[model samples]
Target chain A: MSETPTPDGSPSTWSEDRLHRWLAEQSWPATLAGSRGHDAAVLETFAGRPVLCTDQCIEGVHFELGAGGRAAGRKAVLRTLSDLAATAAVPFAVTLGVMAPRSIEGVPLEAWLRAAITGAHDAATEHGAELVAGDLAMVEGPIALAVTALGHTSSGTVPVGRDRAQPGQLVLLSGPVGGSLPSDRHLEPLPRIEAGVAIAAAGATAMMDVSDGLAWDLYRLARASGVTVRLETERIQPHPDAEDAAASSGRTPLDHGLHDGEDHELIATIAAEDWAAFRREGAASGWHVIGTVEAMDRSAGHLQLRSPEGHSAWLPGAGRGWDYGGGE
Target chain B: MSETPTPDGSPSTWSEDRLHRWLAEQSWPATLAGSRGHDAAVLETFAGRPVLCTDQCIEGVHFELGAGGRAAGRKAVLRTLSDLAATAAVPFAVTLGVMAPRSIEGVPLEAWLRAAITGAHDAATEHGAELVAGDLAMVEGPIALAVTALGHTSSGTVPVGRDRAQPGQLVLLSGPVGGSLPSDRHLEPLPRIEAGVAIAAAGATAMMDVSDGLAWDLYRLARASGVTVRLETERIQPHPDAEDAAASSGRTPLDHGLHDGEDHELIATIAAEDWAAFRREGAASGWHVIGTVEAMDRSAGHLQLRSPEGHSAWLPGAGRGWDYGGGE
Candidate 1:
């Protein structure tokens, strides 16, 4: 049989044997015990700091390859970093589990992969993180990238989960809400580390990144806090881009603004009286308040939103939540 | 437009989104999160402690759907846990990364997935490990599984690597040598953890698992240690299964034993004086001595072998290695 072309396009000798030989020649980065030849590699922590988070971004659902490799890489970092941000964690390192197509042969694949890695590096450096271990394999269809980010949080900055929200607290959002849609916004949502850390530092009772839309995420905050939430829909700030898209599409700007997810902004709550001080602290670091928490029947996990027209748009389905099938 | 039909021939709402939602509802067995969603996990030491290793086995490369889900699941876990055996690392915990096709709607797919997890659990438990975290996703094509295993070894046991061999150490092979063709053996090669751990504890100088075949893997051991290695062809041991296949196919048994990769057995070396002790220790563990480690010129990465008929078998291109795209 004729030999298949290699990545370099010469008569390839990458038979199973040749692949082993090639792997043997690579000088692995650090003090890994046996380099890449062993079944599993053992990595040493340089500073006794360990960070780990795994994120899965699917194809068609996450992005199309035509969207450009850099954005895909950036999104990959953001998805993991957002999780880190939710916990007030700082990025330190990352490992990638990339599933690329087997048929997309040659330099293009390598080049694309390099671009993705470069994007990750850029974002990692911005967050003070670095890429460490990586696993690459070729599969049959659309590309998928799974990243595990390692980070460190300063002592005592524990996870400020929604459970910490107290009754009669004021709920706030960072910056404008809802714009990511029909394009790279969903593909490259920003990780709100600065806002999250600031909010935590300012003594916010509870926090979470707004992954789903505002209505749905507020429900999460309500369910976690065992109280009902009251929102002034008229005060619900909208991103200018989202406003333009809704007006042009003949859809309610409120609908698009409140339901259009992928806004990686922080949604936090503080004691009602603490709002001014929190706002002052947040303003110096960049933040905006949107609503407040109230006393509703603890048994009723409901969220109340008053529309601009003095009507209630309290959507029970508003916070459908990012339901992973079967509900783990 | 009509929705896609399920495997059961019903209209399906089994969209990727819906499947993700469904998966999220399934309660997972509680698992210890050593790193609990961090960037990397840490362990105190490696001396005599078990290390776990697992890799995802997707449908196309590892098996086909027609191959039967029961066997496929078993094969997936076996492939991963076998690596632990090679390192003499006792098996402990494993996490699953599954990508299921959305078209295979209904309980059948769920059954297949659960079966695979059950198979993994059984094999792991049999080998002294437990199944831990599992992640599931619905995609557009062939199913893929990523199994990550965690293991710990007993105190005082050292991790035997390819680079730790000393000159004059007798090389040994455990059980069968090769013949895990692209068939059943490939799907079900036995892992040699017991033998590996036993040999290490008995003072085997260096060792490695033979997944890529005797000749190619030995070359790796030699290159890593910066030493030259020469093999005795006649001393090569063949698995009985390979010997039987060779007899019927009119191919030399030696070729199958030395070249065909996927024999997940231990290939180790013990210092000459420790040879008796090694054999005695490995006797209860079931290993066979194969050759010797020698001090020779570095550039002569030659493997010498004498045929059963007292003729040379190391002729150019006579012995084969795995075709890892010809990098060997």
Candidate 2:
């Protein structure tokens, strides 16, 4: 019996061996082989010394489909790397679950997947890690990629967390604190791994990657650490590029620096005594200290923003951040 | 700022913690701990060996939106466990990536997530595994869960893939084979883990889960192994309940036996001499011998069905396993 016809019955139109041949032609680095592209990888030690994190990059929420394949791929890997950076964990390996639209087919689909994986692999390689096990499936509509990365922090690594800061510690911002929107800074966040590693190695008190904006994320840190945070508006460092976008958009760059998420830089606190040496050690590589941590009423888990005149800018507010708590 | 109201949100809506608490309240045995509820569990070995498999279950493709919280959760974990069963890998621990729609507020969403986690925990516990790491995200739409489970077969544990069968080998069915419509068997198809472990231990030559129906998947195995497979029409065992459904649908139960996917049972080949012992070992437990491997020929990659009257059943050939290979 004849099988379903392909209109003209052209055997030349389809080649199942395409994917295999393409994969074979590509050269892969030796270091990445053990943990990347294989069905499974054996980890030497994942029990007590591992660092694990999960991040979701949704279709419209985390990224725009219009970003095209290359950027989509880049964004997918960066989102997860940003998480790893938050913990000051060195890169290791990652697993991804990708969902694509039903309308995608043939070369375009393969190319998209290849680009995403390659982008991730290249980035991981740059970070001294690899891309490992991943799952691919077709879905009905928008594209979504879920990534999980596992890493190991060498012994004595300070586990960077929002809750590790102590009262009376000096609040610090690692670098220029803006450039989150219009600049596409949110789409392509630098994981700040180097800064994190340096700080942790130098005995930093507590740390976290600035994702949900400096103002808001700092609030989370202060709340978790049971401290009241005071911010000097004049000293807040806004990314120079953010100011350009803000000028054109009729908004203040400080607003962008304070409210925009995805900066992916480190926001940390160190004991006031350690601040000078810490800032000196960090500044050799361009890290900066933006402010100080002062004693506030314990009952006030509040974030007070001060203008140049030392006047309060607002009342207790949930500073601008990405609200993933769903609808009202 | 006030959040916009959605139908799924109200004062009585669910909270995340409460939902997690409810998930902990499921009725499950203690041995299921490694499998049930953790971010991700680490298993030492599966049946004394190492094996790894991951399954991602999306909302629309894997389960209906109306499927109760508990059922949805159970199905998600089962889907992953089933994959492990197919590979004959003893399940160890599971890492979950759960994406929930944000529209529904409060308890229902929490309840659903909790239920899903619990279901996964139940399956893990049943399979003697642990839940260790998890990634959670709020998405724009329907809920989906991805479970990545790790199992350790003994160091010597090698997957009995379908392509390794040889001529003269006995083709065996692990249990009653059929009734794979999504409505009935999709949610609760038995994972042939026990059968898989037993078959592997008994020295199976090649194996695979009987998804995408017997005839279609058999074709794939034959192609992979470079062998011709012959199936006895009279000998092919139909599911016990296939006849009733076939009657109602005005189709033959044999059709159901040959076409329905999602059974998640193991279909494997055993050496000729080991056939009798294998059958004897599983007979009380429901394994059956359905066919034999034949010499490779021009049509070696095809599945030839020998009807009772020595005729061929060329009616619409059964076998496109569900390929949800697009975006959503």
Measured on C-alpha atoms, candidate 1 has an lDDT of 0.62
lDDT of 2 by residue, A32-122 (tens): 3122222234333332245555566777777776666566666777767766666666766666677665334322455555666577667
What are the C-alpha RMSDs, in order, of all predicted structures? 5.7, 6.3
- Compose the digit string of candidate 1's lDDT tens values, residues B154-272: 56666666787777787788776655664467777566777877877777766777766788777767666766566777777677767776877777777788777767777887876
Superposed Cα RMSD, model 2: 6.3
DockQ of candidate model 2: 0.17
Model 1 achieves a DockQ score of 0.23
Give a tens-digit lDDT track for model 1, residues A177-293.
766774357777778777776776666777767766778777766765667777777777777767877767776666666777777777887775566776655453546666767
Q: Write the per-residue lDDT of candidate 2 for residues B86-205, one digit (tens) a residue.
A: 556666666677777654643456556666777776767777765655666666556778776665454455556666778898788877666666346677766777887677667776
Model 2 residue B185 CA deviation in Å: 3.7
Best by DockQ: 1
Compare the candidates by TM-score and give the number of the best one.
2
Per-candidate DockQ vs. reference: 0.23, 0.17
Worst 10 residues of 2 chain A by lDDT: A10-19
